[model samples]
Target: MAAKDDLGRVGEQRAAAYLSDRGYDVLDRNWRCPAGEVDIVASRAGLLCVVEVKTRTSLRFGHPFEALDDRKVRRLWHLAHAWIDAHPGRAVHSRVRLEAIGIIGPDPRSGMLEHLVDLR
Candidate 1:
């Protein structure tokens, strides 16, 4: 894998650990459907969260979250719905929402992680 891909993988793993430590039950990771992909799927307080993770070595251009535009958010939503359809038992009667994680550091595992509940 590319260095960039490795960073992202570590960032996603860090994001998952962050959620798990905070009492959220992680249902999936790197979930994909015909529509697209979701970085993380977790639940807490009867709510299902679809998380988009962006990792970068530095913020030379912008924050990691800046990578996601309106188009990407729309695609994430589409992917979330597709995930729900594919996992009926898991997402049954649940309220789904979009979220994001941004990581910036030389080592993503030790990077600064930020969580945004809004993608719009």
Candidate 2:
């Protein structure tokens, strides 16, 4: 696989670990539907969080969280609803949330990870 792909995988792993550490129960990874892809689907405080993982070498280009635009948010919202509806247990008292996971690098030496909750 390409180096960028490897970096993305590593970044996703890091994001998962980070979310788990924060008491979020990960229900799925790479959840998909007709709308689009949701990088991580987790629950915290009885709310379902749809996360978008954005990885980059640095902030030179732009903030990683900035990559999730309005269109992406709309897609994620649709997917989140679909996910909740698919799981009857969760649908009763569930709420949808949007988040962004930003990874700074795969450098290992100085890599940084950021999780922005409720982005949308």
Measured by TM-score, the strongest candidate is 1
Clash count list over all predictions: 0, 0
What are the per-residue Cα lDDT tens digits for candidate 2 across 1-120?
998877777777778888999998888888777767778888888787888888899888898878788988887888888888777775554467899988886462248877787786
| lDDT, residue 72, candidate 1 | 93
Residue 30's C-alpha lDDT in candidate 1?
90
Encode model 1's per-residue lDDT on 1-120: one tens digit a residue: 998888989999999999999887999999877777789999988888999999988999899887789899889889988989899888964588889999998999887899997667
* Cα error, candidate 2, residue 86 (Å): 2.7
**What TM-score do all the candidates reach, one by one?**
0.95, 0.87
Question: Against the true structure, what is every candidate's RMSD?
Answer: 1.1, 2.0
Clashing pairs in 2: none
Candidate 1 CA-lDDT value: 0.88
Q: Indicate the worst ten consecutive residues by lDDT in candidate 1.
A: 88-97
